[model samples]
Target chain A: DAGITQSPRHKVTETGTPVTLRCHQTENHRYMYWYRQDPGHGLRLIHYSYGVKDTDKGEVSDGYSVSRSKTEDFLLTLESATSSQTSVYFCAISELNTEAFFGQGTRLTVV
Target chain B: QQQVKQSPQSLIVQKGGIPIINCAYENTAFDYFPWYQQFPGKGPALLIAIRPDVSEKKEGRFTISFNKSAKQFSLHIMDSQPGDSATYFCAATHAGKSTFGDGTTLTVKP
Candidate 1:
């Protein structure tokens, strides 16, 4: 219920294509993150940005990339889409140790 | 290496029954444990959280029981209603970052 919104609630892309998902937050939280939610796997962190230009890799950051050039926008890009990379993507924002606020989630599929 | 492991892939309970979900972690460095609930087509929402220092935390019908020595924590829903049925995830934090376990799908039948 926070001010977080994800663009293109659903997307279907072919394999070996380029795709980018956007996450926008109005909360202006200091930390931003991207994660993929899959059945029996929960939510896995892909990439996160601690500041405008400071980003870090997560445990599942193999074929994903991220950029945070502004305070409210973070983008997750799939350089070359794969079948295994298809899942529900979520963007979350958190400040300090408070609960992280999440977007509605973007469901992506690769065919 | 998965730092957190959650059990009971799915669960079913009658209305007003209690539902319990367990989570265990391999790393003792994790200081923060939180539970989140998610509904279909929606994102995960914070339900409750607990620190290692406290053995238990309660908020409304949701309670978090933590055992530091055992390196485990759990969520218990008292008087769980059909509306409380959803996917529950347990997570742990490592230096400002968090990792989630495979969620438990709870279906409370009315």
Candidate 2:
């Protein structure tokens, strides 16, 4: 197992509230990714960071923001949560373009 | 547009039977193809991977068959076991970015 961990394993928030999911890695990998998994959508990348302070948007980046201040920490923030945004979030770490190691996942629900 | 497409959303087989999962991609730039396996309540884990330069790669009971000209790849599980029942995902990567297939659920009856 990779040294990746996602905080707040389960969370529930009201619509319009703010939510932030944290992904921490101890492996000191170069790349980190945030993804959301839905029933039919599978896993869609929300954002990813190649290095500290270097971030990029992915397939479903709308309404979500991410920041990577250090090599080990990547943060995903939802400025304003919505019911449609409810999904299981996963964080991945990779040393290069090869295989990625995923976290356990965070199950978030917005009501 | 989905770059990778996986078929037979679900599959069932008896123990010891081989199960194959197919995936297709339209992007010719994709050079890395990998398969992931996920059990309920867990994140997807790397099962095996293959590159376009290779026709096939085998690891343990898992094999990745790639057809670069057809822009397709498939996963073959030999001597499938009941414990092998899980969701399988095929992914393609080019220029360091990757796209994942929806996933195929495999059920192996003992």
Candidate 3:
């Protein structure tokens, strides 16, 4: 409902392969975040963008990278996929530090 | 280390029963606390939120009780229905950054 869309709702890749997920938003929010959800880890932040070309790493940033060239698009890339990286990834948008609206989610599996 | 800790990894209750989830945090800098609900195959959505300045905040049948001194907060669903069965997460925010609890899976039987 927040006008957020994540491309490649589901993906399966082999280990050592490259994978990238995209997040697009229409709310013109300044804050965009990428998170991964696992069985016991809950939602762990992967990366976040505060503005165009302004991004920061999160708690679980290892082996992952993110880039935001525009206000509406945020990208997360797995340089080399690993079995441990298999999880549901979520994209969220927020006007500020307040309430964040999340996308449906992207389920990725690495074998 | 986990910034926020949530209890009761899973719960089950009969329809029309009250279900409560508790969370504790060690960071006093956290000023905002929010609860999120997620159904199977869906992303988590905001259910309710509260600030440290307030002792309690309610939205419809959902309530957030906060105690700044105790560094804890809890979510209560009154007369919960089967539709309310879902995984719940509690999060703390500070300086635009947020830390979330592991999550609690709630099952409401009719």
Candidate 4:
């Protein structure tokens, strides 16, 4: 298993509240990604970072933001939570174009 | 638009049966194809992967058949066991980015 850890394995928050999920890696991979998994949608990329402070938007980046301040930590923030944002989130890390290693996953529910 | 498409939203097979999952991609630039297996409550893990230069590759009882010209790939599990039941995802990668399929839930009944 990869040395990836996601904080707050489960979370429940009210609508319009702020929430942030953390992904920490000990592998020192160059790339880290945030993804959400839903019943029919599979895994949808939310955001990814290539290096410290370098980030890009994924297919479903709306209403979510991410920051990578160091090589080992990547953060995903939802400025205002919504019911539609309820999903299982996964964090993955890889070395440039190689196979990605995923964390256990974070389940967040918005009430 | 989805860059990669997968078929058979779910599958059921008896023990010792062979199960196949198919995936298709429209992007010609995709050079790497990988399959992931996820058990209930766990994140996905890499099961098998293939590069377009080869038509087929096998690891253990798992095989990946690739048809670059047809823009398609498939995973075949030989003599699958009840423990093989899980969700499978197909992915395509290019330039450090990956697109995943909707996923296939496989059930190998005893």
- Grade the docking of candidate 3: medium
- Name the regions of candidate 2 deviating beyond 4 angstroms: none
**3 or 4: which has the higher TM-score?**
4
Ranking by TM-score: 4, 2, 3, 1
In candidate 1, position B27 carries an lDDT of: 90
Fnat: each model in turn: 0.65, 0.65, 0.67, 0.67
Q: For candidate 1, give the DockQ.
A: 0.74
Please provide, for model 3 over A7-95, each residue's C-alpha lDDT reduced to its tens digit, 9 standing for 90 to 100: 99999999999999999999999999999999988999999989999999999999999999999999999999999999999999986
Candidate 1: which docking quality band?
Answer: medium
Clashing pairs in 4: none
Instruction: Put down candidate 4 lDDT per residue, B1-110, tens digits, no spaces.
Output: 99999988999999999999999999999988999999989999999999999999999999999999999999999999999999999999987789999999999999
> Scored by CA lDDT, what does every candidate get?
0.93, 0.93, 0.94, 0.96
Which of the CAPRI classes, incorrect, acceptable, medium or high, describes model 2?
A: medium
Query: What local lDDT does model 1 show for residue A4?
Result: 96
By lDDT, rank the candidates, best first.
4, 3, 2, 1
> How would you encode candidate 4's per-residue C-alpha lDDT over A1-111 as one tens digit per residue?
799999999999999999999999999999999999999888999999999999999999999999999999999999999999999999999986679999999999999
DockQ measured for candidate 2: 0.77
Q: Is the docking of candidate 4 incorrect, acceptable, medium or high quality?
A: high
Q: How high is each candidate's TM-score?
A: 0.97, 0.98, 0.98, 0.99
Evaluated with lDDT, which candidate comes out highest? 4
Instruction: Give one digit per residue, the lDDT tens place, for model 1 in B1-110.
Output: 88899988899999999999999999988888989999999999999999899999999999999999999999999999999989999999866788899999999999
Report, for all candidates in order, the number of backbone clashes. 0, 0, 0, 0
Scored against the true structure, residue A85 in model 4 reaches a CA lDDT of 99
